[model samples]
Target: MINKIRLAIRNDLEASAETRQFGSGWISGFLALVASIAGLLLLLSQRYPQWFSMKELALIHNQTIFSFVIQSILVIAFLLALINLVLRRNKILGFSAITLVFASLLIGQLIDPQEQYIANAYALGFDWFVLNLLLTGLLFIPLEKLFGRLTDQPLFRSEWREDLFYFLISSVLVQIISFLSLSPSMFILETTGSWSGFRLLVAEQPLVLQVLEIMLLTDFVQYWFHRLFHEIPFLWRFHAVHHSAQKMDWLAGSRMHIVEIVGLRGLTIIPMFVLGFNQQALSIYILLVYLNATFVHANLRFNVEWLKPFIVTPRFHHWHHGIEKEAINVNYSIHFPWLDKLFGTYYMPPHQWPKGYGIGGHPVPNGYWKQFLYPFQKKKKTK
Candidate 1:
């Protein structure tokens, strides 16, 4: 049964809408599978909080709202799976979902009231992963569906599995990444203790002002850092993995090399951390950057021509991934388009997007592991 279910899923992943009709229960089955898996993961995280859950999210674990959420997800999964079982010819997806629902229930029954979690050096961000996935998916999926630039693009577009894997890896390892990314700034701050007065002055400013200052400073640092990745052959290899996406969507931006993620975060965050931005301001900036980055890479078509000059938009960043000759090495800033204009690398045609995305040759191989090690591989020499 397990083997059959696995094979069915593998085949379904490769099948398109043309092959699998819309009313053939596949959509319900897919949703059921997703909910079941999510429910199971949440159950495990609740059972083994020390290893599977984030300490920061501990307060919400036993909350009535959280428990209600888990129950609702499980109920929805069961109903969808049952509906699919009644409607679909193949029972793999439906049966698999039902089996998972039962498994989660079994785990839930074993939860102890006295369960205690010890402090540890490391923990999986499964809790964070679940929340991030839910929040981002709920917010962007609907927007993309209603107003997406590429209306015909399916939710499960080509290479979606690879991008989803990238998203999972980054979120699951958030703890390690945060620690390493911020370590450099923390070390520098500890050594250079004379900047307290300056830092205090910066921190005392209004929250709105601090956020704007953060945007300006970080964008400037990111502008050069992004350009360096394009110009340098070695760095270009790492950055090429990002541009290798043939389709543009919210998930596309997550397809970055871990090295680049660490390096970029470490460098760009130096100013924010060293300058001692208020924690509230830093939190706001972090949220803004998250939304802004996702928005720029989204497959949405908003005619915000007036705002393009002041802030970066989907059109501006799309050109960076454009495969056309004109799009090569342009639009490097994340928040502001003016930096690109100042540096003379900005390229945007009025009322135009790219013919297509990705490197001209599509040199980067598919899959997460291959792309991760691609930069280190020796290139072939043509005689």
Candidate 2:
């Protein structure tokens, strides 16, 4: 009996090894494809600048095929290191290497020529990446450890590559859309007017007051739109992709359907346009929203028993992604807790975390484009 058990364990290990090997090969192939396309586009942009159009050339210039190549190389190296560490059961070295890579990327970005990259690369570095890494490591790391102890599931044990792939694809799509949509007059209108308004708003307010106003307004809009997505079945299908994530983390927030992303942005901008908030206020608002949204979805735990009634913390948003029927359509607020409280949708019973996450029954396509068109597809028969 003991010999049979040993044999079974050995077989399981072998299978797991084969699976990892397959996944690594797949990732390598995909990266190669990305590199090839980027290289071809770069060559075309250089040799046939007139045929390619200014925007097309700018896309290549802004992302700089070089940056993508570097990122891909780093990702491959990290994956190989991770596999070795995992097989050797060396958690400390694994995490240390991961942190080192992230820090190195940040340092590289900081020193790079800002003009070589798109606006978002700079925005990502200064506005989102640095603050998030610091906050996550300081606050979230311990919280995740605590959660792991309680739940028997490591809060941070999620597939980072999947998250990275989603980001790369979405970013590529966004750049393509921007290139196709570019109009000098429209650019002037968006940048000059909206940014000017954002600046003026912050200029008049105290720093603390400015932060408060930005948080309140952005969350208020996000709450309503989030609820709308749930209430309307058609919209729900697209939004459902977000809820489909079986695991939650800071990067999990990027799983949103492309249409939902564009739609939500359009919805959020209405108030910004009509009210005319200055660029500073807008900048601060964007920064706060991105950070808070990342915070709430992060693999963190906070013993803020008193604050739960006011702010939308990780505990609150986890319930929003809860797999249970009663938990569905609850906890809609993005930052503010009062909105969900007012609507009576907030559901976080004491001493309980959700059994699982994702839609209870409905399954969706996995491919990017298929998921993009999912809302328009015929509904599958629900079990």
The prediction achieving the highest TM-score against the true structure is 1
Encode model 1's per-residue lDDT on 268-337: one tens digit a residue: 8999999989999999999999988888999999768899899999999999999898999999999999
- Model 2 CA lDDT for position 359: 82
lDDT of each: 0.86, 0.59
Q: What is the lDDT of residue 285 in candidate 1?
A: 95
lDDT (Cα, tens digit) per residue for candidate 2, span 1-383: 65764444333333343343443332233233333333333333333333332332344544556456546645754674465454543233344345445654665555443354233311111112222333544565556656632344432244444454565455445544333333332445575664665656656777667667767776788888898888878778878878877788766777887777766776666555445555677677777776777778776665578998888888889889988887888999987888887888878888577877888664876656666778788774321
lDDT, residue 123, candidate 2: 17
Give the C-alpha miss distance for residue 331 in model 1, angstroms. 0.6
My TM-score estimates for the predictions, one after another, are 0.94, 0.61
Worst 10 residues of 2 by lDDT: 121-130
Candidate 1 lDDT (Cα, 0 to 1): 0.86
